[model samples]
Target: MSHFTKCELKMTNLTALKRALEDMELDYTEAQANQSVQVRGWRGQTLDASMCINMGKYDIGVVSAGDGTYDLTADWWGVETTKGISEAEFKDRLSQRYAYHNVLQACEGKGYTVEEERNEEDGSIQLVVRKWVSD
Candidate 1:
C-alpha cells in the first residue's frame, strides 16, 4: 500500500510579501483585491520561478529538484543566478538586488509616472503607478 499526504499550503500574506519585497528592494504598487496589476519585467528578462514566486507568492508548477537540491528557475531580481544558495538565501538576495529604492530609480529613469499610493487591508502600503513608452 502506498500512502500520500495531501498537504495544502496557504498563500503567503500580503504583509509577508511586502516585507520580503522590502528586503529585496523591489519596487511595487499594490492594487485592490479584485484588481490586477501588470508586472513589468526588467529589460531582456523573462518571468521565472523566483520572480513568479516573488510576484504571485506561491510556488508555480515550474520547479527543479535534484540530489536533494531545489533551485528556482528565475534570477533573483537584479542578482545573477548562482548555486549554493538556499531558498531563504535566494529570497534575501532578491530583496537586496531589487530593493524598492533601486526599483523606483529604475522606474523614474524609464519615465514612468507615479500614479497612486495607498494602504492595503493588511495595513501595508502599496504604490499604484505606471509609465508610458514613446514609440
Candidate 2:
C-alpha cells in the first residue's frame, strides 16, 4: 500500500495530471475537496489517494508525497498480473502525456501559440509553438 516506484515522475501540477489522465482515457475518480479515496491494493490492503485509477483488480493511487509533489502508489504485482500492464509502460504513457500537458500549459502562460503537433513513428511527440512580436 502506498508503494511508489523510483521512476522519473514527480507529479506536481494537478491540472496537468488531470489533463494527462483524460488524454489517456483512463477510468479514474478524483476525491472531493479535502477528502481522499481508497485505492485497492494487494492482499486486501488499501491506501488513501487524492485520485484513483481503476484497473479492475487493483487501483493506482495518486497520493501526495508530502514534499509538494504527488507520486503514484499501487501494488505492481497485482496490477500486472490482473491487467497485464507493466509499471514501466504505465510510467512511460503517463509521463509523456503529463509532460505534454505541462508544456502546453507553460507555453500558454507565456503567450505562445501551438502551431503544430505531431506524433513521430518512434512514439515521440513533437510540438511547435510560436509567439507574435510587435514593434
Candidate 3:
C-alpha cells in the first residue's frame, strides 16, 4: 500500500503551467474556481486539489500552498509503479517545461519576439528573444 506525498514546485503562473502540462501530453484538469478536484490516492485515499494530473490508478494534484505558490501532491509510490517516473524525475521534467513556456510567455508579454529556439546537447534548451526598437 502506497501513501500520498506532496512536493513543492514553487509554481505561480497558471497560464504557463497549463501550457507546460499540455506540452508533456499529460491529461489534467485546470484549476477550477471555487471548487477542487478529487485526486484519487492509494487504497481509497484521496485529496482535493485545485488542479489534477490524472494517471491510471493514481493521480497528481496541484494545490495552493497559501504563500502564492503551488505544490504537487501525489501517491509517489503508485505513480512510480504506474507511470515509471520517480518523484525527482517528474519534478525535473515538469520544472523544465514550465520554465520554458514561462520564459516564452514573459518575453512575449514584454514585447520581445523569439529569435532562436535551440535544444542543447545536455538536455537543456536555449531561447533568444529580441525586441524591435525604432529610433
In model 2, which range of ten residues has the least summed lDDT? Answer: 1-10
The worst-scoring run of ten residues by lDDT in candidate 1 lies at 1-10
Off by over 4 Å in 2: 1-8
- Model 2 lDDT tens row, 1-135: 344343457899989999998988888999999999999887788888999989898999898888989988888888889989898999999999999999999999999999999999999999999999899
Task: Give each model's whole-structure lDDT.
Answer: 0.41, 0.88, 0.89
For 46-100, candidate 3 gives per-residue lDDT tens digits of 8888899988889998988988888999998889999999999999999999999
Model with the higher TM-score, candidate 1 or 2: 2
Which structure among the candidates has the greatest lDDT? 3
**RMSD of each predicted structure:** 15.7, 2.0, 1.4
Q: Which clashing pairs does model 1 show? A: 23-95, 24-95, 24-96, 24-99, 25-98, 25-99, 25-100, 26-98, 26-99, 29-127
Sort every candidate by TM-score, greatest first.
3, 2, 1
**Candidate 2 vs candidate 3: which has greater TM-score?**
3
Clash totals, every prediction: 10, 0, 0
